[model samples]
Target: MMETSKGNTSPLKVQLVYTTNIQDPNVYSEVQEQRESPAPPKTSAAAQLDELMAHLSEMQATVAVKADISKRHLPDKQDHEASLDSMLGGLEQELQDLGIATVPKGHCASCRKPIAGKMIHALGQSWHPEHFVCTHCKEEIGPSPFFERSGLAYCPKDYHQLFSPRCAYCAAPILDKVLTAMNQTWHPEHFFCSHCGEVFGEEGFHEKDKKPYCRKDFLAMFSPKCGGCNLPVLENYLSAMDNVWHPECFVCGDCFSSFSTGSFFELDGRPFCELHYHHRRGTLCYGCGQPITGRCISAMGHRFHPEHFVCAFCLTQLSKGIFREQNDKTYCQSCFNKLFSL
Candidate 1:
């Protein structure tokens, strides 16, 4: 019979039930003893499960710590890489400054061959100090004062000779200081006034006949003179009968009146008004026997008015179209044909 105690659980007894005995007896006994005893007060299944969960949590914590350490080292590794890159960049710039070209090494600009030793950096290329020579005069211009024009180097003296302005009067190069006027350049000592043989230095001048002249000489020598007043005709004047005269001095010879604006006749080298000239020197009209005041037609040593110089038979104007003259009498073609065609 099984015994039971009050409020106390009894140990379970496991019976060894065997079917076959092919194995060793000691092995079978050891297995039966392990099953029969109360497992020597072993921990419960739930406690063992809790212990396994704690071990799993500890392993997870260890893995998390390792991950955090790796994450902290990642930035340092990146910074180290960036520092290496910066160092490399600085080295490259230094190499460039030392004239070590980043591309394939090129030849010297002047010598047209591979550059070996010390080189100069100029004109967007490399060159040897001895090879980089001036284009003009063929002199070496290494680290010396020089000028560049049209992509070619030139020494100072040769550059000035090639580009400096030339004098207009002497036709010599203007080396130091220059005077510019009349759209030309001249040396300070070579610039002179045209009228007077005097040197002009920073003074006002005038140009005439493609020559420079001082103000006083230009006004006195080249200024026009009036024919009537015999004075300098500086500004507005009248030109008539091959003579220049002031506006106030232009007068009629016969009437002695000022002619503002009208037709004037020249007689005996004198200017006369229109009315007085017609009365004094105009020809007489043959038809009216009066002085011709306007245009007159002269034929056969006689002058006639334009309206009176017509066909006598037809009384038609003969100034235009064809006409015939008989016994000094003008006749139209129709009147002449009707009277004399037969």
Candidate 2:
């Protein structure tokens, strides 16, 4: 008879019975055996390497599948972020168009108060519509034309009064038309000669000391007059003896010769060249009877050359000291005493 038993710890169990024919048939021997299943043959290193390679190939395929999935979805993620940014930008623009953007609150430049509701932007500042007014007149000005000067706003009337060109003569503002002369502005009707107080025509005029004058008035009032011709010296005049004269008129009073470029002398407000002056006014020497053109000595209404005036008897030059006169002749005091004294 044979029997088998199996359990969790033991893999296989077998019981065997054997009968001896020579002995007692009835007597039987029992044998029991337990055996575990044998393990398979040890594998080679090459086989182990091949198995590792197969596992690695499977892992690589799985990683490649994950990468492909990520690559396909990356564009969608970026597009979603970009769309969110664009939507935010559109919302901002819409807010601005509706005047609800997060703009900083401004203050009125004129009143220095917080500006609310409607505002006027000008002169690099913000102001309430009603607060922006003309600085000069202190009147509200907006939507209408205005002017600015020195960082202050003004209306047209006040602007013109404060800044417009003025007449040089009257010192009044010239609004409509202006005439510029002598580096100054004037009203057309006010542009006139300062001397005659007459308005200048299209003809030429002159300026002196920043005052305008007509040609005729300028010549008569300011031009130098020739002493000889008694006419206004237009040009090419000579100045002598504190008087001005035309070149042709400046001649010798005696010879009437032009002293255009020569030395002259003035006698009784008349010009005389050197030759004529000397010849006409030269005194005759009493001793030599010749014209005393050089240094001379005069005594008793008579002129004598310095070298010729000598003592009558001694014949010495009478250079200094008092001399005596007799019969229209001069003698030294010593000679006179020697000749007359007893």
Candidate 3:
């Protein structure tokens, strides 16, 4: 067919536009015509509008598909991010909780320190961290709460104890226990063991075996011991003064400072030996500067030592050394020589 382009000497022809491959002879010929054609008629406004509408419709379909894809992917992405955030938040909270303190202050008795687990003391009583205790006997009085409520820290049973008292020794305030202890009270460890004839670390008051044994009794390997007197202890029954004593006993009355080698001297209604003993006296001697070992040396008249007279010329000591009395005034040798020369 002859194609016609604009008034530019082109054959007038209708070349069909195509997308798929043209296999038919007619379709191939149409492509060849389109190739030869130099120009085509200017599309009318209606025709242009129709073409623009077709493109707009295709674009709209493509935009709808993209929006659907975005909608499907956006929700999933947001949910995943939120789940991760929640897990991170939980882990952070777990870490913070793990660091919480297990013990609180004012829970420990002696040291007033924090206590995490259970701790039971010797007295068989439950106690808090800050509580009164006896330093001498290691007796725990009570929790700080009772003291906080009332001014006292111990019960009256603790006052008159003859031996070790922990709370009193530590100087903590006595509840009623210290007062009672001062009267007739004794700790559980105060009873004397009849076997060893020695006071045990603890006591059993009502225990009237009359033959009481202490921890030492259980620890003793062999040999039965006396329940009344210790080995070498003498027994006496003089009215209310029935007390047993050892022949070689040298224990101190003041600080338990024992005397050794075994000796005795009568002093203040008690036997005291020279060893493990000391005496106090006032007067001092000018010669030795110590309390006289009980006597003094003196210079009298012409029988005086040289130390008792000064040299006639030098006016110094006459030099018979110390503890001496010569003719008159005590004088050193140098002074005596000067006096003799004069």
Best by TM-score: 2
How many backbone clashes does every candidate have? 0, 0, 60
TM-score of each: 0.38, 0.41, 0.16
- Scanning candidate 1 in windows of ten residues, the lowest lDDT window is 22-31
TM-score order, best first, reads: 2, 1, 3
lDDT for each of the candidates?
Answer: 0.66, 0.68, 0.38
* Model 1's TM-score against the true structure: 0.38
Report lDDT (Cα) of residue 202, candidate 1. 61
- Which one wins by lDDT: 1 or 3? 1
In candidate 2, stretches whose alpha carbon ends up further than 4 angstroms from where it belongs are 1-133, 140-145, 148-153, 201-204, 259-265, 273-342
Any runs in candidate 1 off by more than 4 Å, and if so which? Answer: 1-108, 112-120, 175-184, 187-192, 197-206, 251-342
lDDT (tens digit, per residue) of candidate 2 on 66-165: 5556566656877655554454455446434433333324777876755434556666666776887888788876535666677677777888888889
lDDT per residue as tens, model 1, 202-288: 667878889988877887788787878777788899898788898878888777898766767778877877666765664767766
Clashing pairs in 2: none
